[model samples]
Target: MTPETVMEIGVQTMEVTALLAAPLLLSALVVGLLIGMLQAATQINEMTLTFVPKLMVVALVLLFAGPALLETLLGFTIRLLEGIPELIG
Candidate 1:
């Protein structure tokens, strides 16, 4: 493939990756921020207090968003595979 085509593919790959990861990452970020605030307010300062909640929220997010994420990744994979001939020739 040409350099432009390669770059385009790279950009699309990154976009798909970000889209798939955003939900879990965002949930973790929000949970962590809230936990941090609570820790500051109450002076709990326990590591597991932060870790467990964020872990649970992330798991919940994944459970809810998993199907959509899978669909997006599958779509991207199919599109990339279909474009292989054009890219090669």
Candidate 2:
């Protein structure tokens, strides 16, 4: 593959990865921030307080977004695979 082709593939892969991961990561971030704020307000400094809620929120995000994420990844994979012949030639 040419250098440009390689860079294009890398960019596509990263875009797909970010799209698939954004939901859960964002959910976790929001939950963690909210939990932190609550802890601050209540003066309850628990080391492990955010873990369960963050996990649960991320799980919920995955449950909701899993199909879309899989479809996106599959589409990217199929496109990449289909381009292999052109890349090799």
Best by TM-score: 1
**Ten contiguous residues minimizing lDDT sum, candidate 1:** 45-54
The TM-score values for the models, in the order shown, are: 0.97, 0.96
| Model 2 whole-model lDDT (C-alpha atoms) | 0.90
lDDT of 1: 0.93
- State in Å the error of residue 13, model 1: 0.7
Tell me which residue pairs clash in candidate 2. none
RMSD of each: 0.6, 0.7
lDDT measured at residue 17 in model 1 versus the true structure, 0 to 100: 90
- Which residue pairs overlap in candidate 1's backbone? none
lDDT values for all models: 0.93, 0.90
Worst window of 10 by summed lDDT in candidate 2: 13-22
